[model samples]
Target: MPEYRRSLDIYQGYNYKKDKQTPVGYLTKIKVAGTDLTVDQTCKDPTNPTTDLKCVAVLSGALWETGVTDAVYLSGQVSAPNRQTLASLIINSLTSVEVVYQFAVYDYDPVAKKYYLAFHANQTDMNGLLEKRGEDLNVSVADDASTEVQSPINYSFQIGIKPQPSAQTLHIATADQKNVVKSWGLALG
Candidate 1:
């Protein structure tokens, strides 16, 4: 089998927000870039061997917001620094987003090292925080003797998010000055 080089573009976009905030919330949006992976095809002896092709790609980003509420204390203690104050302040949290891509191999080309991508998914139509990864391109098969065959392999994408520093802010801090404006917000509740 011959070596092959291919380029594929995958675009993904999703909304992530906190379920609810104790006192404040931030507006955020996250855009994820595309990813590329290599695929190989091999055969043993004169017969085509049973083979499997698996790939896993992970994408992550942090969402931040400014001017969140924080904890405050009253003027009464002189040494107790960790005491609960009667005042409130602004705070922020980090939200990490993760996505994965999975596909199963079904066939291959002998002349060119290209594998077929085939994966099964449920056919449902619903709109409510759905993780969508754009379709993946197929591997090309070409030889010096014949024209190249454009075989589009199929795959599926999965996405999720995890909230970091689950602290409630009482005050709205400066996003530009504090760099909180660069982060994505989880929810507005």
Candidate 2:
């Protein structure tokens, strides 16, 4: 059993106008606000880092398929403010923006006392609106007062991802964090 850190990296690219740049390469800290529980792993435990994950590392997939789409699940526990922000982030990036959404699930290296990314992904064939969080609906006829207690929102969105070789490797391969841009966009800070 080892501690893990899962993060979502949204590609920084030109704005909808394609005139100026937007926030470039922001690694979104994926977390469920107000809830203290750790989220579950969505992708498979990455194979031997020392062996697998490099270019041409694997032999084949089932039949003619060389790779498979890894589905990443979001917990329904995400707060309302977060969901609204996520929705805004997903807008327009699906096509013209060419925003590449990536995910990093890190394997904690105890000896180093730090987290190193293991798995990665980028945006592919999917609609951003599809990543919709649950919305409230009014119902006239509801359950009786004696019915079971109210269940917390369990709605979630799924991001289908393919392995991000470059980002994943660079995460550990990089000698220092200086080259890695701390923040981006108009600020560039």
* Leading candidate by TM-score: 2
Q: TM-scores, in order shown? A: 0.15, 0.26
lDDT of 2 at 28: 28
Cα-based lDDT at residue 158, candidate 2? 29
Task: Give model 2's clash tally.
Answer: 0
- Candidate 1 per-residue C-alpha lDDT over 1-189 given as tens digits, one digit per residue, 9 for 90 to 100: 211112221211111112211111111112212211232211121112243222222111112122222111101110111111101000112131221122111223334343222111111111112122353211111112111211222222222322223332221122212211212223455
lDDT computed for candidate 1: 0.19
lDDT of 2 by residue, 1-189 (tens): 212123332111101122222211212233221121223212122222222221100101111011222223321222234334445444424332212332333334445444344333322212111222344211011112211112322223323222222222112212112123111112112
In candidate 1, what residue range of length 10 has the lowest lDDT sum? 70-79
Q: What is the lDDT of residue 52 in candidate 2?
A: 20
